[model samples]
Target chain A: MTPSSGASARTQPLDHKEIVAAPRTLVLVGNPNVGKSVLFGALTGKYVTVSNYPGTTVEVTRGAAEIGGLRWHVLDTPGTNNLLPMSEDEQVTRDILLREPEYVCLQVCDAKNLRRGLLLACQLAEAGVPFTLALNMADEAAARGIRIDTDRLSGALGIDVVSTVAVQRTGLPLLLERIPEAGVSKFRPRYDAAIESALSELEPLLPAARLSRRSLGLMVLAGDDSLQPWLASGASAVRLERIEGIRRALASRYPESLRFVVARQRLAAADRLHDQVVTRGKASAGSALARRIGAWSTDPVKGIPVLLLVLAAAYLFVGVFGAKTLVDFLENTVFYDHVVPWTEAFLRFVVPAGAVQEFLVGPPGLPFRETSGFVIGKYGLVSMGLAYGMAIVLPIVATFFLSFSVLEDSGYLPRLAVMVNRVFKWMGLNGKAVLPMVLGLGCDTMATMTARIMETRKERVIVTLLLALAVPCSAQIAVIFAMLQGLSFAASLWFSAVIVLVLFLVGWLAARVIPGRGSDFVLELPPLRVPQLGNVLVKTLARMEWYLREALPLFVLGTLLLWVLDRTHMLGLVERAAAPVVVGILQLPEQSASAFILGFLRRDYAAAGLFQIYQPYMSTGTMTRVMEIQVTVALVTVTLFIPCIANFLMILKERGWKTGLAISAFVLPFAVGVGAAVNLLMRRFY
Target chain B: MPALVQRQERCPLCGMAFDAEGQGCRPSCPLATGCRVVCCPSCGYSFPQESGWAGKLKGWLDRRKEAGR
Candidate 1:
């Protein structure tokens, strides 16, 4: 999506010939996660990309619905704030609007937070688009006893207003019914006379314009870059210079950025409309709660303690419960005892020959040839994939997601973001970046993708570094849980101390070394509320559906690759090569290197290696507890050290390969060196 | 009790506000409105409202799926 100051506007109608022979198109636009997808689903039915993440629909999603024998083309856009865009997603929103569709715009807003979203609504209104305001999440406001007067709102804004709860499909059909009516009229901004005069003169210079002349004039007035192509295309060198001259002359009279001023005026218009339409209901319980919690979560004494408690709760849930309890239950009860054994025996029964059975289950004298099964064994990708999915990872994440949902819904997470903003800033990120960090703890794969929410590319890379190095998603957290399970609470303390110290030190260092920028913290802390049980459930389900859909296929592919490696004995060859690095440099056994490979496949698998081998050593006194701490630190560091494949791919996609490779080259050696030094120090310091 | 939370007697750590009639709705949930132990937005604070047990059931199901995968 185009950033507001950079995007040039070309007002153009969509070509009917280019479109399939469908009826006129209706486009839905809104701020992020304001139920645009749900509305699309409601209107178009069942087929929308109904995932829980923001920016999930990276492109405009088009669907069709037949109403009164006419097939309606529905375009659902990514969430965006202003007509002038920032962020890639916002630019996509601009592109869709640039293609003038026939149906009126379904300008959706979260009714509870009209003040923030209405800023965009006002921009669209000023852009002279034919539109209707689709008020969403009305039930949320109504629960606070807030009432909105739709008729009054429509009159004030000069557009149709439809109050809806998209999840319930509430007022959706009514909106579809009113689309044809709202399509007949258009709205435009009223700029000051000086600006209008300049716009009128400049409008004639823009070529092949699809928008109103005033809109192009305003964009030229805004000094947006999107107009660069349009300006450069037709004008000769001299004409282009003349047009550029006009842009500069006009930029001067409007000393206040034209974008910002235009936005403020438009927001004021929306505010005026809101004032006319919304009543000051009895003080909402939600608003009151927001005020109260806002004090404590922000105040240092109570806020810091509260923040600690939250971190502790999260650690316990994702680390201890998800990793230890769930992993043990699934790996022990389900996969190890029932599924794997059953599959091995079934293979023995069917294969009919000793070598084949051994090949299917295991080679000579191993309890079960891990390589033998058709579905999951060393050779079977599907079985192993399902086993890993259900057995090793599922239970822990269930508890983790449930707890995560509760925290998110209660509004504590946003407050936590504000509290940590200062510390994170030293790492070159703002408070808003904390959301991704918290998410990084649960799953860095998802968190890395979420870092795009940060305003700048530089901030995004910094967050990515911290996520790759310091944060351990639920899977790795579980491995940590298992390692320290029987160790003294003091071990837990030591383990945590080093990780936290590293998190801050590495973040500070990366921020300084990476030469990135950071934003000042001023987050919109949403009112804390009792998390809704139902909302959390559906939301969690949607998120899981998204995770499983993205994750399982990778697991299968990873397993298939592993099978190929094992079959060719290439794993043996690679293992031998990695063993020396593991033993000679990290001072661990050759076997430990395989854990790193597993770490790439599934996050915590590397840490699980320590669990299997190290327990016997410390218990037998050949290995000291201090040694355990050192290795644990190293494994944790390395596990958090490199970007997981999923996150790495996202970075390559978003930041491009040069940045992605540079990040990896820097982090890999840093992880290994940190591990070696921390090992050496623990042996000395303790 | 910050006045905002005290007027509503909610756990400020988790903001959960509801009108009087909306009482007794998410009784069993740890983050439910009346828990007042942490911040909680209302079931009403929802695009996907947890109107009843359906919400809790979904959360449970999601967790289970998460564990399995």
Candidate 2:
């Protein structure tokens, strides 16, 4: 049978004489954001009207235009990434192609990304559509040192190819002139013989449609269900069953999805076409600079120093500027010097002296008198919870988010993933896990959710366990640095060493135990462009908002729990219950038990509790060596403890209760065990 | 007309520096509609897309290139 004679004629072939006599429909089709609409406006001017495609919600714009004194109808279809009807929008584009086979297709493409555009061109070619390929945004390609030889590309495809900067109307005259000569691409994507035979069998049964029967058969073989409406309308049950049998026979031939197989063939054709016509020259100055930085960032040798500089810069900003400068001003000057006094006076005026007054303002003495603790007491909601949330944690989270956004915008995070892949491989994980691990520093709760990106359940569980046990959130880290900065730099070193050791030991053990294969390392290192200040500010503000929303209420709840524990005398009972572990083995003060317990509410809240203990040193002007060792042990234990309540709940949600509870069970005992060991070792050495 | 700036990003896997935001989604990806990740055109590895004013500025320059031509 001829190509057009079999089930291929889904619709009546347009009468050649009639098509030439009437006004032609020129359809503009492309991937999204590819300047299709701009070209539409430039070609048709003010003559466009948009309405939803019939039977679908996707809008298609139609207008009238005059090209070379011939009046033509122009239809600007919705942006479709593919012609295979993967979505309702794409289905509409495909439907239009099937309905009006005579319409001329103008395929607009991004000149900088030709392969993707060429993939669609391949699809159009298989459909037997007469089309012209317009390579848009030529200037961008040029700036990136990309030069596509349109003449050679045209020769390869045996179709007219015109390069146009549509926004500037550079090649409009030539493009318009070439449209009339549009012809089917001489190039075709070849499928396997089995698929070709299946197409022949299905072609006889398919009713006349605009798409070639071969393309329709390929869609059918690939299991596209979106064509059910059309199939139901035309095919008898016997024909449908035969088509299904053909599909099943084809499916048995491949181990992978036929869709993937077909796509691979098409892309291979695109790549071959690209190699013939595309050339790269020297990059422009800005792109060259970004490329150089991107190269240095992932180079194993150069990346080490770059990583150190980044860490140092983060410490200088968050620890020094944020915790020291911003926190000092907000807490000391704003809250302590003004707001506390104002709240006290207001409380004194509102209530008469009694038990009630004492509960609210703590007997009107020093802020930490430690009596009658409630709303205004030393550990009260206002005094400690709100102060810590707004004054201390806010600056820390703000600076951290600011720095993080810059790293993200500059595209350094993926390179970091590459650099760390080797180390991660030791733990049966790969570089891809680094995304969520870095994210865990911002907030373990969100990072636990992001662990879903890992390829296997085993990798997710390991990453989640590590994040819970070792990655201290930004607030906790900030408070740790602040507290340790006063004691000694070695204090911070001890804390880091202990956490790193715990992470590696646990990861190594878990990798051996976990039962799935880790995904291989693969990451895209985006160019290291200069981050825009505006984007960084917007992202920082967004993260700060998330911090306030997530952390503030937990702070208040933690403080209230503390107050209730004290009031019910449960605090003393628990402290006494853990006294042997708290004071005897760990060598921490009895009061330190309360901080460890509060850490279960929020890691940073517990860190803030430790901060309060060290604050008196500012006035006393000395940190005893014993206090330093105790502080170091406390920080390490808190860092390795079970994830905070929010993150625990997320783990339970994402990983299911069994694994989540198992992880929590493991971490609780492991953290204390490591803390006890660290205490003994440090005491012996220091 | 001024030369347009090409936002080239190198894929770590293949080292092809295509337009960072210009990569297209695979036909089968369900998240293709609103996902904020950019796929590498060469290797198909997805990374987070750059956001905010910088992406907007790059878009504006692309449009300017179209118009200037």
Off by over 4 Å in 1: A1-112, A117-146, A149-287, A363-366, A369-388, A486-494, A553-572, A615-630, B1-69
**Could you say which candidate leads in lDDT?**
2
Off by over 4 Å in 2: A1-285, A365-372, A617-621, B1-69
Identify the leading candidate in terms of TM-score: 2
* lDDT (Cα, tens digit) per residue for candidate 1, span A183-225: 4224454667666677777767766544555665666666667
Give the number of the best model, judged by DockQ. 2
Residues B19-60, candidate 2, lDDT per residue (tens digit)? 654463322322123333345543444444434444565466
Candidate 1 docking DockQ:
0.06
Q: What is the iRMS for every candidate structure?
A: 11.9, 8.4
Deviation from native of the Cα of residue B32 in model 2, angstroms: 25
lDDT string for model 2 (A158-186, tens) is 89998889889788778888876789888
